[model samples]
Target: MLGLLQRCLVRQGQRSLHSGRPALMAVSSDSGVGTTQNLSESDIHQDIDKRVKKSKVVVFMKGTKEQPQCGFSNAVVQIFRMHGVDDFDTVNVLQNEGIRQGIKTYSKWPTIPQVFLDGEFIGGCDIMIQMHRSGELGETLRKAGIESQISDPPAAKDTTEETTPSTSSTNVKS
Candidate 1:
């Protein structure tokens, strides 16, 4: 399990390594998730819809999985890694203002680091933390078609590094 955890972290780090951050070539959405140019609100909604549906597990967060922009996001990412969820996708909400706000409206949850399982909103960091703490996250992941890969439910690990910003934690609106 520890090997799995490390591998996930390493993969997360590598994912951001090759992202071509060139200036927006066309009208593409700020978040790189969209395949087309900047879109209308409805179109953005469609993009988001497509995004969540594309993967069994996805997180709409402040930054990419390689580098989470907030401590809460890091924590959530870590929790997912600890649970052996290495194949999940993440959207960097900070990259696109529309996505940042759009996701809030899409999920009707006021927060970044939003999680989706099987195309359903699983809530934000707070809810994920609650699920992780109560040992429900593992079961939820398995039920959602993501493999838990653990013989027993493991505890959530704090992956927030030293420089992790000092801000309100999960569930605390800051």
Candidate 2:
């Protein structure tokens, strides 16, 4: 009887991992009977969908926005900032198991730091930085109607200042 309860608990935990909802198994003290909670698989699927579509630019990385766990993720964020992008979202893949696996399958890229721009997969850090350096990133932003300003030096301004004529006196005579 005790062995059966242990098995049931393990099964419930596994279900929760995939279902995204804790499987409630009610075990009566005297009766030693258990009841399982029923959760639809669609419920989990829909939640993942909503999370993925919530942001314009979503980066699924190893860590949080404040601290990126991986070097690749750090580099990607830095490049985005250098491109003058202040608005974007990040998903710490380390936090969610489903998202971590689902994103790799969704993007068809087996990498931790995956970047998505405007709901489209934008590849990894190397590809993004390459595009950014080649000026294609700005073009892509324009295509998305994001209106990102490329770094351009401010034009020099002309300042008119009064100049006094210089007079030089010869050694002998002026």
Candidate 3:
């Protein structure tokens, strides 16, 4: 049943990509039956927008936060962990091919493990890594009204004592 859904989703995604039209999603109803739903391109964008805004931090990756499938996805998970952000939402792209493609179109980004902070696109793994290294990620979280658990390093003390000026100087000719 899952395989059938995947195939349908893949075909739908392909058609949407090639024909430049909306795709039909196979939605499973409460009666344990599948039904087709007409999902427009704008609908997908709206859905993505809602999802990104649903949390302060939302990660659309290849797997869940607990078990990321791709290395890039794992890196994103670890970066969030380093910031002590444990309550963020995670959407596993591998579970739904339509979402996997839809997100790319929505964000205009060609990669997975996308990060959204307060409904704003923070970027992918490489961008996240750069932001993390530059302490921008923490600042961004702070701006988003989420405090990062990782504290800043203490300021360096001025330990250098005053030195006397040299009494003699040497001159060289070239």
| Global CA lDDT computed for model 1 | 0.73
In candidate 1, which residue ranges exceed 4 Å CA deviation? 1-31, 34-37, 150-174
Prediction 2 TM-score vs. true = 0.58
Residue 111's lDDT within candidate 2 is: 84
Task: Report, for every candidate in turn, its global Cα lDDT versus the true structure.
Answer: 0.73, 0.62, 0.71
Ranking, lDDT, top scorer first: 1, 3, 2
The true-versus-predicted C-alpha distance at residue 143 of model 1, in Å, is: 1.0
List, residue by residue over 1-174, the lDDT tens digit for candidate 2.
224434543554455567653333221222101111132334434544555576777787766446555556766666666667767777666655666666677778988788877778889877876776667777887787766577433444555442555476658764
List, residue by residue over 63-167, the lDDT tens digit for candidate 1. Answer: 666767555676678888777788888887766777878888888888788999999999887787778767788888878777775445555676767468867
> How many clashes does the backbone of model 3 have?
0
Error of 3 at 104 (Å): 1.0
- As a whole number from 0 to 100, the lDDT of residue 165 in candidate 3 is 66
